[model samples]
Target: MKVAFTAPMKPLDHPVPSGDRTMGRLIVRALELAGHKVEVASTFRSWRAEGGEDVTREVKKLALTHAQEISEQWIERGDVPDVFLTYHLYHKAPDWIGPYLCAKFNIPYVVVEASRAPKRQSGNWALGFNAADAALAQADQVVALTNSDAQCLSQVLSKDVLTVLPPFLEEARFEISQSVTKGSADGTIRLLCAGMMRAGDKQFSYMVLAAALKQIADLPWRLTIAGDGPARAEIEPLFDRKRTEFIGLIPWQEMPRLYRSHEIFVWPAIREAFGFVFLEAQSCGLPVVGGRVFGVPDIVEEGTSGLLSDEGDASALAQNLMSLIKNPHKRENMAAAAVENIRKNHSLEAGARGLDKVLHAALERHQFKRKAHGGR
Candidate 1:
């Protein structure tokens, strides 16, 4: 099967490195791994970070124009895709192309990691909300990245159309020695965090982490943050300069080594939609500690592979951190479990298998429906 993929939030090859881009690339890779030919449908981003009605109107118009052109070109080349797949569609960045192309070509439409916010039905994001709702309704199958997202989507989409596919990693990319030891040689617990230091949720997560670290000041641990962004100046002062080290923006290839070197992966993960870092860290055999909110718990099995504290609760987060720091035995056990958990449940092969099943079902259902409608 040939799949036409589009990510309205951010293109898969976007120059800036972000979790969104990473997930987009992962989806493309997973589809290819499933033996499907994947083509990126468009690079036109529809994300509107902050805008009024006029700004959104212009973006929608531009998106529709791009979609029209792409459809015409594909038709001219006699190479329309068999399936249309859109990733990460929400009110902030609704897809305007996939549905149009799928309708024009009479192909199966699938949406992955789609979230629907009913509250945006009549607000500044009303246009985007409606557009996303329409796309979801038109989808032959909607793949939710987490149960939380699935629940929200169920409000508007049928339960039959919804399926939960957890976030996954390409395990082959991270090669860690099975005999590698946890923590540094001098008995210092090495904690690592990898996230862009931006304002809003990222900055707030940093503040929460800083507060948690302050509570465990007496513990024998050192934190190394591996990311950089505009809010670094504000985020830096929140932590003790001596105990914390900031190594800005480690390349993607080097992240696995960084995770292997650390004993624990810590991130407050405020409002996180299932962080890929958690999967990456665990794949490298490192236990994780994150706030218990949204999809964090989906990846980090509490008391099994990692620990979770209540979202934004510095005290609880601190206690979770201290528990791991004080008990090297527990950390080592969780580290082993983390690696196994990802291998069994979140590996690229697992995701590829899941996609193969879902995409094939979608194609069959689409054909059945079309036949029922007398080929429309």
Candidate 2:
């Protein structure tokens, strides 16, 4: 099968590293691993951070023009895709190209991680909301990355069209050769957190983490944060200068070693969409402690691979951390379980199999629809 992939929120090759970009690349890789030829359909990003009627109109116009040009090129080159797959579709970054291109070529249109927010229907993002809603309605298959997203999507689309595909990682990419033991010889528990230091949700998460660390000040632990962004000035002050080390922006290739060297992965993942960092950290045999919000629990199996505290509760987070810090045996056992859980559930092979099943069903559904509509 030939899949034309588009990520309207962030392109796969975008220089600015982020979870969205990583997930976009992973989706393409998963499709390829499923024995499908995948191509990035376009790099035209439709994301609008701020809402304005004029801005929304201009973006929609540009996206239509871009879609027309792409369709022309595909027709000329005889390279029309069998399936058009769009990732991370929402009001902020609605996909205008995939549906247009699929209609033009009579191919199956699928959306991965499609989120619908009803509150945006009558606000500054009204146009974007409408566009996204239309795209979801036209989609042959809507892949939700989390159950919460699936529930929201079900309100607009038929339940039969929506499927929940948990976030997955390429386990081989983060695998280390030698065995990594938790805790240092100095008897200090090394904690790791990798996330962009930005405002809004991230800043709030950092605040919670800092507060939790303060509660556990008596423990023998050190935190190493690996990320940099605009909110660094505001977020850095939240942590204790002596206990925290800020290592700005780790490269993708070095993340495995960073995870292995650390004993515990601690992050108050407030409102996170099943953090990829959790999967990456657990794959390297490190126990995790995160906030029980959104999809964090989906990745970090509570009591098995890691522990979760109530979202935004610093004291709860501190207790969870203290539990692991006070007991090395429990951490070691959870570390082993973390690695096994990732290999069995979140590996690339498992993700590829899931993609294969859904995409083939989409193709079959499109065929049936076309045949029922007089073979159009």
Candidate 3:
């Protein structure tokens, strides 16, 4: 099978990539691994801030122009891919030509990691949201990254069925050729947090963690935050007077190494579809401390891997942090368990196999639907 894939949220080359970009790349590789060819039809959107608010319009125009080119290619190319797979269509960046081109080419149209946030039902985001809804509804198969996302899609679209394929580990994360320990016996506890500081991000949560850890400022523990974002300026000050250190954005190549330097990984976000970083941390032999809600529970097993506190319960979060800090033996056991858990459940090869099953099912359904229509 040959597949044409796309995503409007961010390009594969975006500076600080998200889970969608990671998943998109993984799926393309997975299809290729399954003896299929994939051409990434995704293009445009550097997302640079050249002239403030005008940049949004520029990104949209570029996306639409690229979509037109892709449409033309689908028409002229003698052999269209056996399938058209789209990923991460948001209200901000809707897919305009996907449904039309895929339908015209008589190919299986499958969407992965698509969600409908109906809050943007009016005004500026409405058009893109509507486009996303239409494209998703027209798809022969829809894949939701988590059960929460599937519920959201069900609330808005009258789709036949949606499949759930959660975030899986990247290939690099599976190489446990060496052992990594959390921290030393001298009372120093190293906690790490790495992610974007976007609009709905947890830049403030890291800040709050820093504040709570202030009670143990005299202890040998350190707070090292990775990654930079627009909200960093606002939250950086909050970590200033404490033992927190901001290391800025590290290259993806260096993430596993950085993960090994820390004992406990902490980032309490409000809600996430599924945090790939949590798995990344676990893969690097670091147990996590995060919020109890959202799709996080799917990744973090309480007590074994790490602890999850109620959202906004700063007191409980601090307590959890102190628990690991106070008990080095527990931290060692948790670290070993985290790496073992990720290796067993979330390896890239395992993830690829899971997605292959979904993609093949969608392909079979497309063939079945085509045969039924032709018979009539």
Question: Which tens-of-lDDT digit does each residue in 1-376 have in candidate 3?
Answer: 7788776667666666776678777777767776778888765543232322345456557766776777777668766777888777666666665675677677778887887788877665665666678787777788887777788888755445577766676646446567666565765788898878754547657666766676666557878888788888877777744667888888787788788878899877556666778888888888888877667777777899989898766777888888888888899899999988877876777767866776787778778888999932
- Candidate 3 wrong stretches, greater than 4 Å: 45-65, 156-160, 171-181, 197-200, 215-220, 240-242
Clashing pairs in 3: none
Candidate 1 lDDT, tens digit per residue, 242-268?
A: 988999999888888888888999999
lDDT of 3 at 280: 87
Across residues 72-99, which tens digit of lDDT does each residue of candidate 2 receive? 9998998888999999999999999999
Residue 332, candidate 2: Cα error in Å is 1.0
Clashing pairs in 2: none
Residue 374, candidate 1: alpha-carbon lDDT: 100
Between the candidate structures 1 and 3, which one is better when assessed by TM-score?
Answer: 1
Q: Please give each candidate's TM-score.
A: 0.97, 0.97, 0.87
Candidate 3 deviation (Cα RMSD): 3.5
Residue 275, candidate 2: C-alpha displacement in angstroms: 1.1
Candidate 2 wrong stretches, greater than 4 Å: 178-181
- CA error at residue 16 for candidate 1, angstroms: 1.7
